[model samples]
Target: MTTLTVFYIGLFYIAAIIFFGGLAYRIYEYSRTPAPLNIPTTPAPTTAGGVVVRMAREVVLFESLFKSNKWIWVFGWLFHVGMAVVLLRHFRYFQEPVWFWVEFIQPYGKYASFAMVAGLAGLWARRFMVDRVRYISTPSDHLMLALLLGIALSGMMMTFVAHTDIVALKAFALGLLTFDWHPLPADPVLLAHLTLVAVLMIIFPVSKLLHAPGIFFSPSRNQVDNPRDRRHIAPWAQALERDNA
Candidate 1:
């Protein structure tokens, strides 16, 4: 048990360091890379309302996914919603006796976990079954999906099928948060589930799953389409321009 605990703790730190270090390097490289010399020649919105509508549709409704393909949009939507619910359910882990609301939502949480696992599986299948998705899919993309599916499946199993000592798990979690190591008697299934979850967290900042944050960095989403008419500049960009000038 001690050896396994040490191994997983070591794996967690190694993965976290590599993932964060790689992400920082990637961002630095991207920052140094020159922007496209050619301006985008896509048709511009003709009216203010049109521009507002376009931005609203893309940001709120994921219009780009719909435009890409309706099925893609549907799968993406389901996967995102399921993920959100599952994340909310995880708050139970930090609380004692769980909260009333969490207890109230326990049934839905189970359903949400099941839905998330199914959604990830469906998305993975869609990636292969659809030609467009298949054409664009990379191994890393598939791995990310597979990892999420594995984590969700393992977590659901822990919640519903496998009996876990929640008290022990909670004690270990609190100990870790307090920077004290209190190793619990190791359950292999719980350990595996936790290891997978830790792996996901470590990889998240580096993966395309980073689009969770990367959406804010997207020029199309973050930058005004009418940059010519409006002097729109990111604060950091403006600072750089001032320093250079």
Candidate 2:
């Protein structure tokens, strides 16, 4: 393998390790953390089954966000749903025989990039145009958006402007999965897109992007508002009560 190939292989391996390992650790911490209050958001579900339905609406419909800000919610939902489809389409690269659904979605996923980019542009514009959002925006927030925009634009360029060796690209991805290192096409646009992807994966665990997983652990979202029926006590509080008794 050439030096470039070796570097990419190593880079991908490291990114995978960091991404998976970091997510695992973060999830473990979230699971272990105590929520001592029954503080589900208002109009909350009182039952476990009701909570599931509520969460489903929140995840799929962005119901709360829609009620709060229709424009932001529209853009945010479009971006998230587009990203999900795009990710599903990418399964072909890693699979020996891509799933039927993934293959079927290729056309939609191919076009979904436009929605993703448009939504991203809208969100980025908010940071600059909305004084409240702009006031709280940090350097890292803009940097993250730039990284995503770069990845999306470079990918679109490869798809629409410059032709990339996608066959070779799939081979390279599968090779990594199988402990073999295939020479990656050093197409500048492709390289730029992939480098940003790797960086995103590496930083995801520590970044605000973790809100994706952390949402599941949120007390207000996940908790059942049944304090009247059941007393809530944290683990430490339980121990203290035992000692006092």
Task: Return the top candidate by TM-score.
Answer: 2
Candidate 1: list runs displaced more than 4 Å.
13-61, 96-104, 225-229, 232-245
Residues 1-245, model 1: lDDT tens digits: 49776676567567767777766766666566544332322464645566666666765678778888786677777777777777877777667677888777767777887667766777899888989879999998898887888887878777888878887777776655565656665887788788788788787766776666455345454333465666545567778889999
Per-residue lDDT of candidate 2, residues 125-159 (tens digit) = 99999999999999999999899889889988987
Against the true structure, candidate 1 reaches a TM-score of 0.73
Number of backbone collisions per candidate: 0, 0
Which candidate number maximizes lDDT?
2
The C-alpha local distance difference test score for the whole of candidate 1 amounts to: 0.70
Q: Model 2 lDDT vs. the true structure? A: 0.90
Estimate every model's Cα lDDT from 0 to 1: 0.70, 0.90
TM-score for each predicted model, relative to the true structure: 0.73, 0.97
